[model samples]
Target: MSPTRSTRALRAVDAPQSTLSAAAGELIDADPLFVRERTAASELPDPAPLVSNLARSVVEVISGVRDIEQLSRWVTDDVYRHLLIRTQHAARARQARRRPTRRPNFVELSVRIQATTENIVDAVVVLDFGARVRAVTVRLEGLDRRWRASAIHVL
Candidate 1:
């Protein structure tokens, strides 16, 4: 073949190979699982609202509400179990003390987020309940696009 014809043939061959390679790369990048994995690893939702709601729910539970069903929506099974046991014990203690169990009378609540990861967060919540201050540490995890409390420590 003539030099020009040979050059033209080479160019045509290389063009298709380059296009095929680029297409392969694009296909890999567009894979559903790969996209989902990347998004799941990189995406982190704001935790302020979640922490506030969870804190309020915990306070309500401690204040003789005993709404485990509603609390389940925002907490993990372990946390729910913990809350159930603790609330029951507190109720019994109050009965033993001959005092009627009632909701906490709090002036204000202050929430401080300690650490945040892609799917986990640690926070401290303080409630100014009339006579004294109550503080609790809460750890939350993101599951199925919603935040739920994984653990709680009352202080």
Candidate 2:
């Protein structure tokens, strides 16, 4: 109840290390950049918070055939249903060609997705390969409790 008692209670809890301080110790950089909410969420989350993070992981996961299954795990249910799998099959297969080398190589892609929700959502994503962002698509889905992307059309 007292100020001193409250201060002591707060001090007893372990505090998170500031990312910048941790980075400073590791000698990583001066420019501070970080995506925080790997966990915390409130009643209202951002309209499109996961874009940068998901983009980063999507490349790593899809880099190998073995990891392809992981894609379904991150995405919400019905994403696969709406995704243009049959349509993109040909292009994806073509891109899957392993070059003549000691190991198979998956094509590197930078995927950008824009998502917004009202009663429903419209998501537009562009996958940028070095040559170009070879693919762009718009998907529509009902705004369930969590973000879900369904039905797609290439643009």
Candidate 3:
């Protein structure tokens, strides 16, 4: 065959390869893994329930009704440790003052979710313990499809 005809034949063979490569690239671009990743990343639990549960857990801890294990289930590791230390100190202070630490009588509780990202939320919670009202700011993180309180600040 002439060089011209040989070059044409070579191009004909490579034409299908290039077409196939393009189709394969499209398929990869539309892969299910990408879809799944996007869906998972965007899927976030409603912050209302999470904030309510966290607020209740904090109240339970402050009332001395919930133990460390129970608190751990609702809060992150750092919050758990912080709660333990604070509760211990409160207990010691109560003992020194010879005052009985009464369980808080929760009259009302309200939770307001301030901000939310893909995997994090900031919530403001107000709890009415009959004679006193406590406001708590909670930072929550989504991990393994569950919301856990990463930090809590009471005001």
Best by TM-score: 1
Q: Candidate 2 residues 110-152, lDDT tens each?
A: 3444434343444444555545553334343333344433443
Rank order by TM-score, top first?
A: 1, 3, 2
Evaluated against the true structure, the overall lDDT of model 1 is: 0.75
lDDT per residue (tens digit) for residues 59-148 in model 1: 778767657688888787788898999888888988889998676667547889865666677898887877889887889776666667
Q: Rate the local accuracy (lDDT) of all candidates.
A: 0.75, 0.42, 0.73
Model 1 misplacement above 4 A: 1-45
Candidate 1, run of 10 with poorest lDDT: 33-42
lDDT of 3 by residue, 8-73 (tens): 778767787879778777887789653312122246667787677677777677656766677677
Residue pairs clashing in model 2 are none
TM-score, per-candidate, Cα-based: 0.67, 0.37, 0.66
* Residue 139 of model 2, lDDT score: 40
After TM-score superposition, what is the CA distance of residue 42 in candidate 2 from its true location, in Å? 11
Clashes of each: 0, 0, 0
Q: Give me candidate 3's TM-score against the actual structure.
A: 0.66
- After superposition on all CA atoms, what RMSD does each candidate show versus the true structure? 18.1, 15.8, 17.5
